[model samples]
Target: MYLVLIAWIYVAFMMAIAEATSPVGSLLGAAFTFLLYGLLPMSVVGYIMGTPARRRAIKAKEAAEREQALAANGIQNAGGDDASVAPNAHGEASGHTIAPERKQP
Candidate 1:
Protein backbone atom coordinates (compact mmCIF):
# COMPACT_ATOMS: atom_id res chain seq x y z
CA MET A 1 0.00 0.00 0.00
CA TYR A 2 2.82 2.41 0.82
CA LEU A 3 4.62 1.61 -2.40
CA VAL A 4 1.42 2.08 -4.35
CA LEU A 5 0.93 5.48 -2.75
CA ILE A 6 4.48 6.53 -3.55
CA ALA A 7 4.08 5.44 -7.14
CA TRP A 8 0.88 7.41 -7.43
CA ILE A 9 2.60 10.55 -6.14
CA TYR A 10 5.41 10.18 -8.64
CA VAL A 11 2.92 9.72 -11.46
CA ALA A 12 0.99 12.76 -10.26
CA PHE A 13 4.09 14.95 -10.39
CA MET A 14 4.87 13.85 -13.91
CA MET A 15 1.27 14.37 -14.97
CA ALA A 16 1.31 17.84 -13.45
CA ILE A 17 4.30 18.84 -15.56
CA ALA A 18 2.74 17.36 -18.68
CA GLU A 19 -0.52 19.15 -18.00
CA ALA A 20 1.19 22.47 -17.36
CA THR A 21 2.99 22.31 -20.69
CA SER A 22 -0.01 21.37 -22.84
CA PRO A 23 -2.34 23.96 -24.36
CA VAL A 24 -5.71 22.47 -23.44
CA GLY A 25 -7.22 20.53 -20.54
CA SER A 26 -3.88 19.09 -19.50
CA LEU A 27 -3.85 20.73 -16.13
CA LEU A 28 -7.33 19.42 -15.44
CA GLY A 29 -6.28 15.90 -16.29
CA ALA A 30 -3.24 16.18 -14.07
CA ALA A 31 -5.23 17.64 -11.19
CA PHE A 32 -7.92 14.99 -11.36
CA THR A 33 -5.47 12.18 -11.79
CA PHE A 34 -3.42 13.39 -8.87
CA LEU A 35 -6.49 13.77 -6.69
CA LEU A 36 -7.86 10.36 -7.53
CA TYR A 37 -4.54 8.68 -7.07
CA GLY A 38 -3.26 10.57 -4.04
CA LEU A 39 -6.27 11.81 -2.11
CA LEU A 40 -8.49 9.80 0.19
CA PRO A 41 -11.57 8.25 -1.42
CA MET A 42 -13.90 11.03 -0.30
CA SER A 43 -11.63 13.80 -1.58
CA VAL A 44 -11.17 11.99 -4.86
CA VAL A 45 -14.89 12.16 -5.56
CA GLY A 46 -15.05 15.92 -4.94
CA TYR A 47 -11.96 16.68 -6.99
CA ILE A 48 -13.18 14.62 -9.90
CA MET A 49 -16.53 16.38 -9.89
CA GLY A 50 -15.09 19.88 -9.54
CA THR A 51 -12.01 19.92 -11.75
CA PRO A 52 -13.78 19.93 -15.13
CA ALA A 53 -15.87 22.92 -14.11
CA ARG A 54 -12.72 24.82 -13.18
CA ARG A 55 -11.14 23.95 -16.50
CA ARG A 56 -14.23 25.05 -18.37
CA ALA A 57 -14.16 28.37 -16.56
CA ILE A 58 -10.64 28.95 -17.80
CA LYS A 59 -11.63 28.00 -21.34
CA ALA A 60 -14.55 30.35 -21.19
CA LYS A 61 -12.28 33.26 -20.29
CA GLU A 62 -10.04 32.51 -23.24
CA ALA A 63 -13.02 32.23 -25.58
CA ALA A 64 -14.25 35.63 -24.47
CA GLU A 65 -10.95 37.24 -25.40
CA ARG A 66 -11.02 35.56 -28.78
CA GLU A 67 -14.57 36.76 -29.33
CA GLN A 68 -13.57 40.33 -28.46
CA ALA A 69 -10.75 40.26 -30.96
CA LEU A 70 -13.00 38.89 -33.66
CA ALA A 71 -15.63 41.53 -32.97
CA ALA A 72 -13.05 44.27 -33.10
CA ASN A 73 -11.96 43.01 -36.46
CA GLY A 74 -15.62 42.85 -37.69
CA ILE A 75 -15.74 39.11 -37.98
CA GLN A 76 -19.25 37.72 -37.73
CA ASN A 77 -18.47 34.41 -36.04
CA ALA A 78 -15.57 32.34 -34.84
CA GLY A 79 -13.41 31.01 -37.72
CA GLY A 80 -16.07 31.66 -40.29
CA ASP A 81 -14.87 34.40 -42.66
CA ASP A 82 -11.46 35.80 -42.02
CA ALA A 83 -11.47 39.53 -42.83
CA SER A 84 -7.75 40.00 -42.40
CA VAL A 85 -5.99 40.07 -45.76
CA ALA A 86 -3.42 37.39 -46.38
CA PRO A 87 -0.01 38.10 -47.79
CA ASN A 88 0.74 37.22 -51.41
CA ALA A 89 2.47 33.96 -52.42
CA HIS A 90 5.89 35.53 -52.23
CA GLY A 91 5.06 36.95 -48.79
CA GLU A 92 4.57 40.46 -50.05
CA ALA A 93 1.43 42.64 -50.28
CA SER A 94 -0.14 43.75 -53.58
CA GLY A 95 1.48 47.17 -53.42
CA HIS A 96 4.88 45.83 -52.33
CA THR A 97 5.52 43.18 -55.01
CA ILE A 98 9.20 42.27 -55.21
CA ALA A 99 10.86 42.98 -58.55
CA PRO A 100 12.34 40.02 -60.39
CA GLU A 101 16.15 39.64 -60.08
CA ARG A 102 17.86 40.55 -63.37
CA LYS A 103 21.01 38.69 -64.49
CA GLN A 104 24.06 40.96 -64.60
CA PRO A 105 26.12 40.59 -67.74
Candidate 2:
Protein backbone atom coordinates (compact mmCIF):
# COMPACT_ATOMS: atom_id res chain seq x y z
CA MET A 1 0.00 0.00 0.00
CA TYR A 2 2.63 2.48 1.09
CA LEU A 3 4.85 1.33 -1.73
CA VAL A 4 2.21 2.51 -4.16
CA LEU A 5 2.13 5.88 -2.53
CA ILE A 6 5.90 6.15 -2.68
CA ALA A 7 5.97 5.08 -6.29
CA TRP A 8 3.28 7.64 -7.07
CA ILE A 9 5.30 10.33 -5.37
CA TYR A 10 8.31 9.37 -7.44
CA VAL A 11 6.23 9.49 -10.59
CA ALA A 12 4.84 12.87 -9.61
CA PHE A 13 8.33 14.17 -8.96
CA MET A 14 9.45 12.97 -12.36
CA MET A 15 6.40 14.48 -14.03
CA ALA A 16 6.98 17.78 -12.30
CA ILE A 17 10.58 17.71 -13.46
CA ALA A 18 9.51 16.95 -16.99
CA GLU A 19 6.89 19.67 -16.91
CA ALA A 20 9.41 22.17 -15.57
CA THR A 21 11.67 21.42 -18.54
CA SER A 22 8.92 21.58 -21.14
CA PRO A 23 9.21 24.19 -23.90
CA VAL A 24 5.73 25.75 -23.78
CA GLY A 25 5.43 27.03 -20.19
CA SER A 26 7.36 25.29 -17.40
CA LEU A 27 5.72 26.89 -14.32
CA LEU A 28 2.07 26.32 -15.33
CA GLY A 29 2.75 22.84 -16.61
CA ALA A 30 4.58 21.82 -13.45
CA ALA A 31 1.78 23.15 -11.23
CA PHE A 32 -0.89 21.47 -13.30
CA THR A 33 1.00 18.18 -13.37
CA PHE A 34 1.60 18.25 -9.63
CA LEU A 35 -2.07 18.87 -8.86
CA LEU A 36 -3.64 16.75 -11.56
CA TYR A 37 -1.25 13.80 -11.45
CA GLY A 38 0.12 13.91 -7.93
CA LEU A 39 -2.44 15.11 -5.42
CA LEU A 40 -5.77 14.19 -7.04
CA PRO A 41 -5.32 10.69 -8.39
CA MET A 42 -3.15 9.45 -5.51
CA SER A 43 -5.53 10.71 -2.85
CA VAL A 44 -8.59 9.19 -4.56
CA VAL A 45 -6.91 5.86 -5.26
CA GLY A 46 -5.42 5.63 -1.80
CA TYR A 47 -8.80 6.26 -0.17
CA ILE A 48 -10.54 3.71 -2.36
CA MET A 49 -7.92 1.03 -1.83
CA GLY A 50 -7.65 1.71 1.93
CA THR A 51 -11.39 1.60 2.62
CA PRO A 52 -11.49 -2.12 3.42
CA ALA A 53 -8.53 -1.88 5.80
CA ARG A 54 -10.09 1.09 7.56
CA ARG A 55 -13.41 -0.72 7.87
CA ARG A 56 -11.72 -3.80 9.33
CA ALA A 57 -9.93 -1.68 11.87
CA ILE A 58 -13.17 0.02 12.84
CA LYS A 59 -14.96 -3.31 13.19
CA ALA A 60 -12.19 -4.71 15.35
CA LYS A 61 -12.27 -1.68 17.61
CA GLU A 62 -16.05 -1.86 17.93
CA ALA A 63 -15.93 -5.55 18.73
CA ALA A 64 -13.32 -4.96 21.39
CA GLU A 65 -15.43 -2.22 22.95
CA ARG A 66 -18.54 -4.40 22.87
CA GLU A 67 -16.66 -7.26 24.50
CA GLN A 68 -15.35 -4.92 27.14
CA ALA A 69 -18.84 -3.65 27.88
CA LEU A 70 -20.26 -7.17 28.02
CA ALA A 71 -17.50 -8.25 30.37
CA ALA A 72 -18.21 -5.26 32.60
CA ASN A 73 -21.85 -6.30 32.73
CA GLY A 74 -20.87 -9.80 33.85
CA ILE A 75 -21.59 -11.27 30.47
CA GLN A 76 -19.10 -13.47 28.70
CA ASN A 77 -17.93 -12.63 25.21
CA ALA A 78 -18.16 -16.09 23.82
CA GLY A 79 -18.05 -15.01 20.18
CA GLY A 80 -21.80 -14.47 20.09
CA ASP A 81 -22.52 -17.99 21.27
CA ASP A 82 -25.39 -17.24 23.60
CA ALA A 83 -25.73 -20.82 24.85
CA SER A 84 -22.29 -20.73 26.37
CA VAL A 85 -23.30 -17.84 28.60
CA ALA A 86 -25.32 -18.14 31.79
CA PRO A 87 -26.99 -15.21 33.50
CA ASN A 88 -27.49 -14.74 37.21
CA ALA A 89 -31.21 -14.26 36.85
CA HIS A 90 -33.36 -16.63 38.81
CA GLY A 91 -34.68 -19.76 37.06
CA GLU A 92 -32.98 -18.69 33.83
CA ALA A 93 -30.81 -21.77 33.72
CA SER A 94 -33.34 -24.39 34.95
CA GLY A 95 -36.04 -23.59 32.36
CA HIS A 96 -38.30 -22.48 35.23
CA THR A 97 -40.37 -19.35 34.60
CA ILE A 98 -40.63 -16.63 37.20
CA ALA A 99 -44.21 -16.03 38.42
CA PRO A 100 -46.14 -14.77 41.39
CA GLU A 101 -46.08 -16.99 44.50
CA ARG A 102 -49.85 -16.86 45.02
CA LYS A 103 -51.73 -19.71 46.68
CA GLN A 104 -53.84 -21.82 44.35
CA PRO A 105 -57.41 -21.89 45.58
Candidate 3:
Protein backbone atom coordinates (compact mmCIF):
# COMPACT_ATOMS: atom_id res chain seq x y z
CA MET A 1 0.00 0.00 0.00
CA TYR A 2 2.68 2.45 1.02
CA LEU A 3 4.81 1.32 -1.91
CA VAL A 4 2.02 2.22 -4.29
CA LEU A 5 1.65 5.58 -2.61
CA ILE A 6 5.36 6.21 -2.93
CA ALA A 7 5.29 5.26 -6.59
CA TRP A 8 2.37 7.57 -7.26
CA ILE A 9 4.16 10.40 -5.46
CA TYR A 10 7.21 9.82 -7.53
CA VAL A 11 5.14 9.82 -10.69
CA ALA A 12 3.39 13.02 -9.66
CA PHE A 13 6.71 14.64 -8.85
CA MET A 14 8.05 13.77 -12.30
CA MET A 15 4.89 15.08 -13.89
CA ALA A 16 5.22 18.30 -11.88
CA ILE A 17 8.81 18.63 -13.04
CA ALA A 18 7.71 18.08 -16.59
CA GLU A 19 5.03 20.71 -16.26
CA ALA A 20 7.52 23.20 -14.84
CA THR A 21 9.90 22.54 -17.72
CA SER A 22 7.25 22.64 -20.43
CA PRO A 23 6.77 25.93 -22.29
CA VAL A 24 2.94 25.87 -21.96
CA GLY A 25 2.89 24.67 -18.32
CA SER A 26 3.31 26.91 -15.29
CA LEU A 27 4.80 26.21 -11.82
CA LEU A 28 1.33 26.67 -10.31
CA GLY A 29 -0.01 23.90 -12.50
CA ALA A 30 2.82 21.65 -11.36
CA ALA A 31 2.08 22.41 -7.70
CA PHE A 32 -1.60 21.67 -8.20
CA THR A 33 -0.79 18.47 -10.01
CA PHE A 34 1.42 17.19 -7.20
CA LEU A 35 -1.07 18.22 -4.53
CA LEU A 36 -4.15 16.80 -6.26
CA TYR A 37 -2.66 13.59 -7.67
CA GLY A 38 -0.02 12.79 -5.07
CA LEU A 39 -0.55 14.17 -1.58
CA LEU A 40 -4.34 14.42 -1.43
CA PRO A 41 -5.19 10.95 -2.76
CA MET A 42 -2.45 9.30 -0.71
CA SER A 43 -3.67 10.94 2.48
CA VAL A 44 -7.26 9.87 1.82
CA VAL A 45 -6.25 6.31 0.96
CA GLY A 46 -3.97 6.03 3.99
CA TYR A 47 -6.71 7.20 6.32
CA ILE A 48 -9.24 4.84 4.78
CA MET A 49 -6.85 1.89 4.96
CA GLY A 50 -6.05 2.64 8.60
CA THR A 51 -9.71 2.45 9.79
CA PRO A 52 -9.52 -1.09 11.16
CA ALA A 53 -6.31 -0.33 13.04
CA ARG A 54 -7.87 2.75 14.55
CA ARG A 55 -10.99 0.79 15.62
CA ARG A 56 -8.87 -1.95 17.19
CA ALA A 57 -6.81 0.61 19.03
CA ILE A 58 -9.91 2.29 20.39
CA LYS A 59 -11.43 -1.02 21.52
CA ALA A 60 -8.19 -2.08 23.20
CA LYS A 61 -7.93 1.24 25.02
CA GLU A 62 -11.53 0.96 26.23
CA ALA A 63 -10.98 -2.59 27.45
CA ALA A 64 -7.87 -1.53 29.33
CA GLU A 65 -9.77 1.31 30.96
CA ARG A 66 -12.62 -0.99 31.97
CA GLU A 67 -10.20 -3.51 33.44
CA GLN A 68 -8.43 -0.80 35.38
CA ALA A 69 -11.69 0.53 36.77
CA LEU A 70 -12.88 -2.89 37.83
CA ALA A 71 -9.52 -3.62 39.48
CA ALA A 72 -9.63 -0.34 41.35
CA ASN A 73 -13.14 -1.12 42.59
CA GLY A 74 -11.86 -4.52 43.84
CA ILE A 75 -14.09 -6.47 41.53
CA GLN A 76 -12.65 -9.86 40.59
CA ASN A 77 -15.06 -10.45 37.77
CA ALA A 78 -17.57 -8.44 35.79
CA GLY A 79 -21.27 -9.39 36.00
CA GLY A 80 -23.14 -12.57 37.13
CA ASP A 81 -22.83 -14.78 40.26
CA ASP A 82 -23.86 -12.04 42.68
CA ALA A 83 -26.68 -12.65 45.17
CA SER A 84 -29.92 -10.83 44.30
CA VAL A 85 -31.78 -8.93 47.03
CA ALA A 86 -35.55 -8.68 47.22
CA PRO A 87 -37.34 -5.69 48.72
CA ASN A 88 -38.95 -6.30 52.12
CA ALA A 89 -42.61 -7.07 51.71
CA HIS A 90 -45.24 -6.34 54.43
CA GLY A 91 -48.87 -7.19 53.67
CA GLU A 92 -49.98 -3.68 54.50
CA ALA A 93 -51.05 -0.56 52.65
CA SER A 94 -48.28 1.96 53.36
CA GLY A 95 -49.52 5.45 52.47
CA HIS A 96 -52.04 7.79 54.23
CA THR A 97 -55.63 7.24 53.19
CA ILE A 98 -58.29 9.94 53.09
CA ALA A 99 -61.11 9.86 55.68
CA PRO A 100 -64.48 8.52 54.51
CA GLU A 101 -66.90 11.41 53.76
CA ARG A 102 -70.03 11.75 55.95
CA LYS A 103 -73.39 13.32 54.91
CA GLN A 104 -73.23 17.09 55.76
CA PRO A 105 -75.72 18.55 58.31
Best by lDDT: 2
Per-residue lDDT of model 3, residues 1-105, tens digit only: 778888989999999999989999999999999999889998999899889999999998987886687678665553533332222245556575777889999
| lDDT assessment of candidate 2 | 0.82
* Pairs with backbone N, CA or C atoms under 3 Å apart (clashes), candidate 1: none
Q: Considering every candidate listed, which one attains the maximal TM-score?
A: 2
lDDT values, one for every candidate = 0.66, 0.82, 0.81
Q: What lDDT tens digits, residue by residue, belong to model 1 across residues 1-105?
A: 346556667776777777767787577787876676556553555567678888999998987887797678665463454444433435555763677899999
Q: Give all TM-scores, in the order shown.
A: 0.32, 0.70, 0.69
Clash count (model 2, backbone only): 0
Candidate 3, after superposition: displacement of residue 76 in Å?
2.3
Q: How many clashes does each candidate structure show, in the order listed?
A: 0, 0, 0
- Model 2 weakest lDDT span, ten residues long: 81-90
Error of 2 at 9 (Å): 2.2
Candidate 2 on 1-105: residue-level lDDT in tens?
Answer: 989987997899798988898786588889889889998999999999999999999999987887787789787756575354655545546655677698999
Q: Candidates ranked by TM-score, best first?
A: 2, 3, 1
Model 3 steric clash pairs = none
Model 2, residue 76: distance off in Å is 1.6
